[model samples]
Target: MEMNRELIVLINARLVGTDPQYHRQIVSHELRENAVWIGAQLHGKDGTATIRTVAALLHVSPSTVSRWFQPGEFERECEYLSHAFKADGSLKPSIPGRGSGTGNDGQ
Candidate 1:
């Protein structure tokens, strides 16, 4: 089972992502998406650094970041990441949650 690093970071969950590599891949992915949206929305990045430069701004390998905007593997990565982890940071049924959170706890 794979897990997303961003959700883990967002929810402050301690559960290790399915695979450390996958976790990194997810984080890198989110960062790329955020950057692209920002660039697109703000109407910036034009007459400026290219995607490779954007990758540098996001602190990821240019190739990796480029993959985010590209059509093929990027889409697959998104799918894998979605099925990888849940909103609350559960890594599917096989892996249990590992946080101090009490989402299902009775108050």
Candidate 2:
């Protein structure tokens, strides 16, 4: 959403009054918590990073990623990683660019 002038002013004013420590603890952590840790083990085998890059590395189709991951899956992952990651995390496949269209991630 585009921020209007009033909203920008409010954000600026709030920032002015906000303590650096409190801002870091309150805002930064929340942003970090939502960010996908694509470098983590279950995120991808090698050095996969970012959702788009992970999808590319895994070769899983973009639609498949969107569907299986319900948008917030990464956020949940940032909060709680699980052992059933890769196995249970399996998603439906995309048509050729060429692959099984089963579980194969074009890899």
Candidate 3:
């Protein structure tokens, strides 16, 4: 979907008076969580989030995401997804001259 400038304005206004970096971090983390949850709903086999689904959304391999689920695996992280979200939170495929859209971006 096309970005709603008005909505972005409203959200940014509400975020005023708070640390911009902190808010950005929070939004980044939340977006990743949301993506994982949505991916789970679509591809999980047991009504739970799966590495394969989340990996697909993050543009990574299943093994990369699975490594994060391992016990005592703090070294692995969702840094890629965080950065990706910061770059573009839409989580849609981009096409030249046509903003990201599974089918349409309201353009």
Best by lDDT: 1
Cα lDDT tens digits for candidate 2, 1-107: 88799889788768755466776566545434333443244443333335665456556555644544556665466334433245334433445555556766655
Query: How do the residues 1-107 of candidate 1 rate in per-residue lDDT, one tens digit apiece?
Result: 87698866855545654477888877776797765543342222122325565566667687776666765544344444445344443444533454527664333
lDDT of 3 by residue, 1-107 (tens): 88799888877778663478877667666655655545434432333345566767777676755544554232123332332332223343444556454556555
Q: Give the TM-score of candidate 2.
A: 0.29
Candidates ranked by TM-score: 1, 3, 2
Q: Which ranges in model 3 have alpha carbons more than 4 Å from their true place?
A: 1-14, 45-107
**Candidate with more favorable, higher lDDT: 1 or 2:** 1
The pairs that clash in candidate 3 are: none
- Model with the higher lDDT, candidate 2 or 3: 3
Quote each prediction's TM-score.
0.39, 0.29, 0.30
Per-residue lDDT of 40 in model 1: 41
* Model 1 CA RMSD to the hidden true structure, in angstroms: 16.2
What's the lDDT for residue 32 in model 2?
Answer: 41
Error of 1 at 55 (Å): 1.4
